[model samples]
Target: MNLHETTVVLVAAKTATLAFGSALTYLSYSAFRRTDSRALRALTIGIALLTLGVLLGGVLHQFADITLEASVSVQSVFTAVGFAVMTYSLFVDIIDEPDRTRSGARTGD
Candidate 1:
């Protein structure tokens, strides 16, 4: 009910969201490596949602003036990086798929 309690709740929620996003990103990457269709799709969606969640959480925390401690910031940065990588992987996969592009080229190639 108090400001501190509210901030603590938000921080905990953000942490959990970031952890789940990281797990999804990792699983998706693993699936892509193994050439699993389900895993790849899961990863794409998971990473996308995770990215959104991270952005939203960061914004919310900033607006609320909540300090997520130094460790959380580190974890958040890593999570953001992971999300970026996964997103890039998904983009590449989509662009590289023969059905998705003409001559399988990603422009200017």
Candidate 2:
């Protein structure tokens, strides 16, 4: 494909990524609000960071005229940090639900 075609495809892919990331972030935030769980809050933040990485990377590369390598580096850092938070959210017992079991079954409601 030519340069124009490649650019179009890249932009389209980035747009789709942004849309899906935004939806995921919204859903995560809603869940966090409903449950008031610290883990959920962390998850929401992680998702938001991941989405921001995509946006910033695209904008830096396309609009700011930054090098592709620099943009990708920025994106990678965000992605790594986001995944770390997400992993922490999964492994740490940030919730204070005393009635909840290890199997995730609520002992009382």
Candidate 3:
């Protein structure tokens, strides 16, 4: 549609993204707390970074007099870093406990 309509749609979409991202970050943080696992902690941080990127981008565009492209660039940087951290978390070892079999039996290393 027109420019104003498009801007409104973008704002709404960004707000929704922020809301959903916040919920996801909270869930990840809760999971990390329950397990006390380093990987889970990293995952939580990654999720937070992603959510923060959206927030920062919005603020920059709306209040910092930054160009839309620049704001999006900042968001992209955070997203990339967040994904990298998540990937690293996958390679991290689990808690320092004996390995468990599928049936929940502890196995010797």
| Top-lDDT candidate index | 2
Q: How do the residues 10-68 of candidate 2 rate in per-residue lDDT, one tens digit apiece?
A: 89998999999999999999999999988888899898899999999998998999999
lDDT of 3 by residue, 1-109 (tens): 9999999999999899899989988998899999998888888888888889999999999999999999999999999998998886765664343363446665674
> Whole-model Cα lDDT per candidate?
0.64, 0.89, 0.87
TM, every model? 0.45, 0.84, 0.82
Backbone clashes in model 2, listed as residue pairs = none
lDDT of 1: 0.64
Weakest lDDT window of 10 consecutive positions for candidate 3: 93-102
Q: Indicate the residue-level lDDT of 89 in model 3.
A: 74
Q: Can you rank all candidates by lDDT, best first?
A: 2, 3, 1
**Segments of candidate 1 deviating more than 4 angstroms:** 36-42, 59-109
List, residue by residue over 21-82, the lDDT tens digit for candidate 1.
67766776777678866537645665755555576557656776766564357446656765
Angstrom error of the Cα, residue 66, model 2: value is 0.6
- 2 or 3, greater by TM-score: 2
